[model samples]
Every structure is written in C-alpha cells, then in structure tokens.
Target: MSHYDVAVIGSGPAGTMAAYHLAKKGISVVILEKEMLPRYKTCGGGLVYRGRRRMPFDIESVVEREFKQINLYFTGDDKVLTSLRDVPVISMVMRDKFDKLLVEKAKGQGTEVKEGHKLTGITFGAISTLHTNQGDFQAKFIVAADGALSPTAKLAGWKETRKLIPALEYEVEVNAEDFARLSSEVRFDMDSVPHGYAWSFPKKNHLSLGIASTRRKKIDLKIYYKKYLEKLGIKEIIGEKAHGYQIPITPRTDGFHRNNVFLIGDAAGFADAVTAEGISNSLWSGELVAEAIFESGLNPEKAGRLYQQKLEKDLLPELHTSQTAARWFYGYRIIRNMLLKRYGDFAMSLMTDLYIGDRSYPKNLMKTIKGKIMEIKNPLM
Candidate 1:
C-alpha cells in the first residue's frame, strides 16, 4: 500500500493545477491519470482572456493562435463585431498539449504523477483508500477532478445535481486561403441552434467548429454540426469525424465536499452556465481548494468547511449570477434579440470586460435588466 497526503484524480487542468499548487506549498501530493500523457481531448480549445490570466505560468509554447476580435451573428444577417484592438480576447490551444504542459509543470514541482491509474472505487473513513487496477493507495484527502462522469463522487454516495448539456466539435482542415481568412477572428452564431449557439474558432491549421445546447430537450448535434458547416460554407471541406461531449452548465448546489473528499472542475460541475466555459473556473477552483486545504492545516473536516466558505465568498456568487443570466439569455430569443439590438455594443463590451476580468455579472441582475429595458423603451429619456 502506498500513502500520500493528498491524491488528485484526473490530470486535466483542474487536477494539475491543484497538484501544482499543493506541491509548490511543500505538501505531499500525487496525481493519478487514467490516460497517457498527450492524449487528445475533445474541446473547442478556446481560452478567453480571463482564463489565460489565471494561469500562473506562461503558455506561449502551446498557444496556437490569439484573436483580438469576436463576431456575434444573429438571424437575418444581423451581426455585431466587437474588437479589442490592443489586447487579445482569446487564446487557442489543443487540450492534449496544453494539459501535458500543466502536468509537466506540476511534476517539475515534485508532484508524483502516475499514468494509466484509473480510480475504480473509494472506501471512506478517517482516511480514504482508492482502489485502482494497478493497486491500492491511501490518502488523508482526495480531490476529484475526474470530470463530468465522476466515479469518485458516485463511490462517495453523492448524486449529481448539476445540469449537463450536450456539445459537439469538429476539427476541419481547410485550404490555405480559407484558413487564412478565418484564422484571424472568432465567430459565434447565436441563431445556428435553438437554446444554444454555434462557434467557429480558428486554429493554426484547422478550424474548431462546434455547436452546443443548454436546453434539456434532446438535440441531434450531428445534424446541427452539419448545418453549421453548411452555414459556414465549409461543409465540403470538413476532413474529420465530428466529436461530441457533455458539458455541465452549473455546479452541484448541495455541496462540493463530503467525508474528507473534495470535487473541482467538471467533477464539481463548475462550468459557466452562460458560456459553458470551464477552464478558468476549474483552474480557479483548484487553486482555491489548495488554498483551503493549506489554510486548514491539512485537517480534512476543517478543509472541507473552508472550501465551501471560499466558494460561497468567491466562486458561487458569480456562478449564480451567470446561471440567472443564462436563463434570460437563452430562454427568450425575442427579448434577447431586443436587448442585443438596442445595446449591442454595450452588451458586447460588458461581456468582453467580464472575459478580461474587468467586470462581473451584475449582482442585482433583474434590476439591472429592468433599468436597461426602461432605457430602451423611453429612448428620449
């Protein structure tokens, strides 16, 4: 039997970020990854400025491209282009290389990473034992960063309470001319899908094209992907099979920790409801858990309480606000279009500010929306 102070399951951004921070703090930590390093992960691979700023170290080596502008398209050719000329709005990177980079950084800081270690079961008590195909390991604390279908949370008797949405992505190889034309900007077509949106993200050699839906009703994502490709005028050029995955739009409200175990990232369902963006929140949540654990002096119970408090104070408020915003943003297309039409620049600027960490969702969002509506209704005022 092997023992460690903390065992981090899943070596994605959340796991590696937690391990990196813990190891840097001189805490004994180990990372268990089911897949080998540099394995491909299905993602749009778009990193907004907020997420890019959260990374402690430089990611220049893996960044495929950066964009300074975003195009928002609506029905009937109504389009708004928002540009931040001086700064990049989003940075792109393939997850395989990016995740490996983070893991390597953690390993450099003395975190032991065990590849091909899949956590099958967990027994909880004062200390928890993790059963894997390779062997058994013991830890005083466990952080489940194992992603959407978290077996760790299930083994601990926690049922999922967050909403999981479907997303489909494709890496399409385009000719040089088309690639060059699209590689400079990011596009979001709001009318491409119902209760969701389609995205065209430019990479170095290909375009990461995808669509996602937040609505509970089942959507044929494959069909939607084909339509999106046709809309982009690239259906004939798409070179690979489409990849699909589920994204959690909300976090578990009941709790994030139970019985000396904690959850972060997709395991905890910490994705942004409005954008389905998980990387920034995942990194932030991982860092927060590490901070909470250290602040608690490694006492698991105290650490769990502290983690919840930190979330309430820092992370949960924004998530709640975003969830409310998403309801209106996606729920009522007429009102959404009205607001966008009247305040397109302001709305886009506010979102851009949020992405760059300059602003947050309004705390009193309903009140804010009411005020905006009044302004639109009485333009003379």
Candidate 2:
C-alpha cells in the first residue's frame, strides 16, 4: 500500500490549495481526481476580489477579464450601478483553465495528482485507507473537497444536511457589439428569477450567463434563464445548451471533521448563502485544514478539534451572518426593495467590502436591517 501524510479527494481549488500548502511544508500529499486534467466545470467563473486577494500565487495568466463596476437591477427600471473606480471587483476565467493552473502549482510543490482516480470506498482505522479505482492508499489524514454532493462525506458517515440550491450556466458566443457592450461590466438582475438571480460574467471571447435559486423544487430554471436572456437583450446569442449544477447554500451544522477525515469547501457546505460564492471560502477552508493538521503534528484527533476551532473563530461566523442576511434579503421583496431604493449605494459598498475581505458581515445584521426598516416607515426620524 502506498502511504502518504495526507490524501485529498478532488482537484478543484479547495483540494489543490490544501495539497499545495501541505506539500510545500514537506508533507507527502496525494490528490485523487475523478476526471482528467482541464475538464470542463460549469460555473459562472467570476472570481471576486476577496478570493483573488487570498490566492498565494498570481493567476494573471488565466484571468480573461476584470471589471471595476457592477450593475444590480431589481426590476425593469429599478437599478443601481456601483463603481470601484480604480479597484477591480471581479475577475473572470474559464474553470477548465483556472482549475488546471492550480493543480499544476500544487504539482510544482511536490504533490502527486492522480487523475481519473475515483475514490470508491473508505475504511477507518488508526490510519484511514482510501479505496480508489487506481488502488488502495493509506494516509494519516483525509480531506474531502469533492463538491456539493460529496461522496467522500457520505462514505465517512456524515449526513446530507446542507441546503442545495440549483443553478444553470451558459457559455454564449456573442457578436462584437454585444460582447464589447457587456464585457465592460458585470450585471446581476435579482428580479429575473423567483427567489434567485441572474448574472452575466464576461470572459475573453464569450459571456458566462447564469441563473440560480435557493428555493427548492418550485422553480423552472430553464424558463427563467430564457426570460433573463431576453431581459438582457441577448436571448438570440445564447448557445446551443446550458449546464446545470447544485450549490450548497450553507455550511454543515453538525461538524466539519470526523477522526482523521476533514471536509472542506462544498463538501463541508462552505458556499455563501447570500452570494452563492464558494471559491474564496473554499480556498480559505483548504488552507485552514492544512494549518490545523500541521499544528496538530499529524495527530488526527487534535487536528479535528483544531479545525473546528479555526472554523468557528474565522469562517463559520461570516457564513452564519450571510445566512441571516440572505433570509431577509430574499424573503421579503417589498422591504428589500425599500431598503435597496434608500440605501443601494451603502448596501453595495458593504457587499463590495465583504467581497474584498476588507469587512465582514455585521454580527448584528438583523437588528441593523430592522432599524433601517423602521427608519423607512418614519421619514421624520
């Protein structure tokens, strides 16, 4: 049996980030990926400023476009455009190239990336054993970064408790006029879908248009996607097909670690409920798990506890705050519109700060929102 210090399942940003850090620290790490390198991943591919700032290496080579402003449209004529002036708020890149670049960086740091190796089973002992299509391997620690519907977490006896939201993305090749017009800014239409939103992220030669909803089973995403495209005046430019996937809207409340096994990124349900942004949290969690393992001296029990402590102190609090804010922001449309109409710039600035890691979601967000609602009701106040 091939033995290593850590075994990471999946080669997305989360898994690669963990493996890169671990291998750089001289730990033997192996990444098992079910698909071959550079496989297409269906995503809007917008890397927000927060996620970009957290990356250890420059991803300039993979970045296709950068935008300094975002346009938020609530209804037909209700909209707000927030500009960062000199700071780019989001960078766009195709996932296939982006993910491959991260994996290559990990490889340079000495992590063994075993492509096309799907993990079939896992047996726990003093040292956990991962049964894969390639072969069985042993490791002192296991990191599951597979994705929203994580097989590793299920195999490890963890329950599926996080809320899974549906999303659809289309890569459309547009004419010069539309491409040039849309490429200058990122646009989001909140009223396009029920309890969800539609977004347009511009890449080098195409636009990644997507719609997502937190409300389960009640939405026809395809119908909404068509409406969103028409609303943007680009329905005719849409490609032949659209890709769909599920995103975890919250973190796992039970726990993130069991024995020597740790779940990071979507596997641990780390995507933000408000924005549905996962790359930043995914990378952050991956780095944290690696740090915990190193701090624990490869002791699984100690590492698990340390991981939980780090999560509660740093990541979980933000996620919880976002969850509360999302409930209010999406639940009451009238109140939400009122708040947005009155404080659109302030709201957008707060969100921008959060995305750039300059600020966190306020712990007393609900109270603040309630106060705002009361102020709106009493104009004299």
Candidate 3:
C-alpha cells in the first residue's frame, strides 16, 4: 500500500481546500476523486462573499457575475428588501468550472490528486487503509471531504444528522441584454414556492433558475419546478440542459470527527439549514480542521478531538438558531415581513454572517428582535 501522511477522499471544494491547506504546510497528502476534474456538479452557483474570502488563489477567472442587489419576495406577507451594497455581496459561478479550478490550484501547491478512483472501503484499526478501485493506500490521518452521501463517513461508521432537501436547477441561455439584467441582481421569489423558494441567479450568459422544497418524503421536483418556470412567464426554456441534486438540510451538527478520521463540509453536516448554502461553510470548516491538525503537531487523535469541540462551540449554536428561525419564518408570514422591514440591510448583512457560520449572532439577536417588534407594531410609520 502506498503510504502518506494524509489522505483526503473526494475532490470537491472541501477536499480541495483541505489539501491546499495541508500541502501549503508541507504535509504529504493525496486526494482521491471518482470523477475527472471540472466534472458537472448540480448546484445553484451562488457563492457569497464569505466563500470567496476563503480561497487561497484568485477566483476571478471563474466568477461569471458579481451580484450587488438581493431581492426577497413574499406571497402572503409584504416583506421585501432591495438593498444594493457597495461591495459585491455575491458571485455566480458554474460548479464544473469552479471545482476543477480549485483542484488545479491544490495540485500546484504540491497535492497529489488522483481522479477516477472511487473509494470502496476503509479500515481504521491501526493505520488507516483506504480501499479504492485504483488501489489500496495507507495514511496516518484521513479527512473525509466527500459530500452528503459520503462513502467515507459510512465506512468509518460515522452517524449523521439527516434531512434531505431536493433541488431542481436549469441553466438556460438568454440574450446578452437579458443576461446582463439578471447579472446585476438576484431574486428569491417566495410566493412562487410555499415551503421552499424559487431563485434566479445569472451566470455570465446563462440564467441559473431553480426551485427547491424540504418535505419529508420525496415529491415530484420536476412538476414543482415547471410550474415555477411558467409562473415567471418563461414560456420556452432556451437551453435543454439542466441538473438536480440533494441538499442536506439537517447537517451533522452534533460532531464530525472520530479518532484519527475527520469529516468536513456536507459530509460533516455543516450546511446552513435555512438557505442550504454550504460553500463557505465547507471551505471554512476544511481550513479550520487543517489548522487544528497542524497546531496539534500532527497528532491526529488529539487534533480530531479538539476540532470537534471547537466546531461545536464555534458553529453548531448558530446552525441550531438558524434552523429554528427557518421553521418559524417559513410558516409565519408576519414574522418574515417584520424581519425584512425592521432589520433591512443590517439583517441581510447578519444573514451573510450566519451563512458563513459566524457565531456572533447571539450579541445581534436582541437588536434583531427589537427591530422586528417595532415593525410589527406599526405596518407603516
């Protein structure tokens, strides 16, 4: 078996980021991926500024559009916010291009990335042995950066907090002028979606339109999305190409590490429950775990424990708070309206913070609640 100091399973943003961090620190690491670089990944392609901040290299090469305006719509409630920020708050990207770009960057940093190697099994008794279709490899430490349906987590006997949110997305080409209009702004149409919402994010010359819901049992996502498109007066789809994927709403919040193995990103249940936005969280958590490992002086077991504790203290409380808030806002139109009206841009800024797993919300909660209460007291003042 080939030996290494670290083995990372998967090559998505989380895995690639972890490899980049470790390799930058001069650690021997290898990344195993089932598909080739820049493969198609079904995503909404919305990356907040926080996610962009975590990248080690410049990502301007892949950013299709910079978003300055965020429009939130509600059906039963009259809450709407059209705040334009001076700084670009969001960016649109194509995951196929974005994921591949990062992997190349990691390789440039001396990371060994092996594509077309599917992880079949893993034995974690003494030194960890990763069984893959390519061959068997052993490592002193393993980082499970594989996504939601992670084979690494399963093989390592990690229990995950589970809730699946299915999303259906369509990438349709549009006229350059129309695309330009979309690129300058992003819309979240809540009226068109009851339990979930419909989003329109512009990417270069294409419009990434999607609709999602998180009902317990699986329903027909296509039907819901088609109705959504029709409601928007999109009579004919310009591009036939489209994709879909699952979002784990209930993430592994309790803990993510076991012994010498650690899980990151969606595999570790680090996704935001309210928006299902996970890119920033994945990058942050990946970097956090890498720092913990380095500071541990390469002691895998101690690093794993410290990483778990810090993750819980630093991230889980906000996730729990957001999840609770999501359930409240989805049902109570009044609360949603009150929040948008009172908090306005400040509230949205806080949302950006929470999306990236910022734990400072406890200090901001009283202000949010006070502003919301004022809005509720007077509809228009």
The candidate maximizing lDDT is 2
| Alpha carbon deviation, residue 122, candidate 2 (Å) | 0.9
Candidate 3: give the clashing pairs.
252-269
TM-score of 2: 0.98
Write the number of the candidate with greater lDDT, choosing between 1 and 2. 2
Per-candidate Cα lDDT values, in order, are 0.88, 0.89, 0.78
Task: Give the TM-score of each candidate.
Answer: 0.97, 0.98, 0.90
Residue 289 miss distance in model 1 (angstroms): 0.3
Candidate 1: pairs in clash: none
For model 2 the local lDDT of residue 338 reads 82
Please write out the lDDT profile of model 3 over residues 66-133, one tens digit for every residue. 87667776655566656565556678889999999989988988999889999998878557888989
- Model 1 whole-model lDDT (C-alpha atoms): 0.88
Candidate 2 Cα misplacement greater than 4 A, ranges: none
